[model samples]
Target: MGRTKRKRLKKYEQNSINLCYEEHLVSLQKWMSNKGWKNHKKLSLKLFPETGRGISSKITVGANEVLLSIPMNIMITYTTVKLDIPVKNIFTIHESLALFLIKEKEKGINSYWRDYINSLPEKLPPLTWLANEEEIESFPSDIKLNVEYTTTNFKNFLNKIRDFIPNNSTLADSLLKWAYVMVNTRAVYVDPHIICEESSLNLLKDEPSMALCPFLDMFNHNYLSNTEVSIINEGRCLFYELRTLSSCKKYEQIFISYGNHDNVKLLTEYGFFLPDNCYDNIKFTLDEVLKILKFNLDNNKYKFIKEHDLHNNLYIGYDGVSYNLKAVLFIGWCGVINRLDSIIFSSNYPSLFLEKKLPDLIKGLLVIKKNEFTNDLRQIMSGRIVTESAQMVLEFVKFRIDFISEVILEYR
Candidate 1:
């Protein structure tokens, strides 16, 4: 798969997509400027039709140039927040930050990160964790199971920190949910030692090193975007420097990649998925493969697969079937393996008789996967699960079926 070709947005859609946050941006710029933050002369905040709100390079930005150099002081992390003894001992980085964000949001203008906080949306796109019964029902079994698991864990965590939340506030849980999403979706990686105090770092239950960078979070993710971020430490000052690995022309949206993630992961985490994501893999569990095969494997072959951990990476993507998948199926087809190592790892194995039967073996799985997508899409399209983020999920499902069909055709 390649990058999806986007159609130009109509006038109204363009207006809607570009959220009106000019005043927030202005205030943030002023506040940031005072804190030793000097934005690149050529860069400005923009609402791109394709990627929503992001930074645009007004002039051509050359490779290796600094796009953004945000100060560490301006970032909200463990270092910035005054963590209480209880929170500092029990909570992870994300949990502590979520609690802090909620408290800060209560401070309308008093908060130091007020402008940056104001710039963020009250709620992000509809996430799987927030999906109600009706909305979750439309999701595929795999996605449904994950959503259920995530929702349970989220509620359990909230229960633990309910004491910090005000009893009178009606929007407490939802506010906490928003804060959780805010931290997970927007927080960038930093070394734990860089932010966490040595005294409390070890006491924290989990290791989570992340910082909420103000303007830097505005740069939306693109898997193909080549950018590198590091801390620039001088004797008296420290700056979070983001360098461009590639050039950007005038008025182009400059992207920084979070990481190489597939549509499924992106959908679950961020409530959005990139179309034609090259990193996508149609993964199947051990039971799923067993169900698809619907044949009892001999003890010897089963043990061999289990021993080698060949059952773990059963997947197919744009490239082709995974080596593990091929090896697993090959074991089923062959009567005797003279050399176990050679049969599984040999380069010449693909040219063997197993190659003749591989396509047939995979076609069944593809058909099943395609059917799942079609069924999920049909349910989502019924208008029951109404949400903008559900629409993104629907779009991804539609894309997946078409993508699988193409792969099936190629395999033929």
Candidate 2:
């Protein structure tokens, strides 16, 4: 009796029942097989109720285990793209990869990486720039301005690539957006110096770290996920490896960290957020702080703040006000003085000079910000909230209100 193998297979069958049956995934699994992807044997795509499509393992995976190690030839890079124009010279690696997708998609069945492209969302959730004037009113002040800037950049990119687009179609607007978001959300970092041609990458204004890795991007993100990514080069052979830093039992959804992004950033960049994200924080520019607190800084104080880079990274998280924010508040009140380094460096130093006024001020700022979020929600939900983008924004607004409300309640 082969009891050992039977027991293991039974355990596997329990979680394997929910395996994805989508044609795209089926084809992708086949493609990976043909491509000789070397990953954990039990790793497979699963449709989870909560997180949608994610990577799962049939058996327990230990720390430092290599989850997926994709070959370089299969990964899509700027070199992988082919277009009539000097696209590499004109566009960024990100844009080039996106354009590669668009061109490949136009080829239909003849397209390379068709199965991989099919797995992508037809359209990423519409973002702030896509919102109507009414809907834009609901966005946070910081996000609203960023949306405007992003819209302008999008237009600029559109103009530059107008010649390549067929019939000069406005239809390509959605297509282009879909392509760009697909790359932006899923692209992984690769060391270009070792793996790419420096001269070719130099033409693009941005860093050459971006590369699209098939099967690898399937892993969903968790702010807390600890995973190690590396490039393995063996003379003519190259590999992209992703390893787990933490152990996981069978049937658990595996996640990777997308960096220590706050809720605002995660929402803006990925169109998603975790309600209980430890990285969630309320951010403020120096001007926003002054406006909210009704405080003014002399040029010297402003100069001091900027000189120390204390004006940036000013935010309130679950742990309370950030060090930079605290320092900025103290500097604004007390003005820049001798021994300011000691004062800023030492947390207790500011407390000695300040009373409850600073704490009260921070709470006031949170209260006002919460009210703005509440008002934004009112405008957003006024109508049916039909679009996925608006719905995402609404979720973010509600979360911010609750977050701020909790902070205000606890600050006393």
Q: Using TM-score as the measure, which candidate wins? A: 1
Per-prediction TM-score, please?
A: 0.90, 0.88
Model 2 lDDT tens row, 1-412: 0111111111122333454577887888788768877555478788766567777887898988888888888888655763333544567777777778887887778987898888877866556566676677666677787678777767767876885555656446778888877887899887777655666556665766789988888888886677899988766677888888888777877888888888777777777888777777788888888888877887777787899899898988777788899888787667547777776786656454456667776887788778878887887778666667777888888878887777777666
C-alpha lDDT values of all predictions: 0.76, 0.75
- Give candidate 1 misplaced runs (Cα > 4 Å): 1-21, 163-171
Ten contiguous residues with the weakest lDDT in model 2: 1-10
Total clashing pairs for each candidate? 0, 0
The candidate scoring highest on lDDT is 1
* Candidate 1 residue pairs that clash: none
Candidate 1 positional error at 155, Å:
0.5
Tens-place lDDT digits, model 1, residues 1-412: 2223432212122332333347988898889999999866457877776667777765788888888888888988777764442544567777777767877888889987799899888767767756667877888787788788778767766876765444625546678788888987899988887665677676466765877998898887877788999998866678899999877776667778889888888888888887566778788876777788785687888899899999998998877888898888787777876677786777457565556788888888888888888888888787565676666777778888877777778667
Clashing pairs in 2: none
Candidate 2's displacement at residue 336, Å, is: 8.2
Q: Name the runs in model 2 displaced over 4 angstroms.
A: 1-17, 82-88, 163-171, 335-337, 346-357
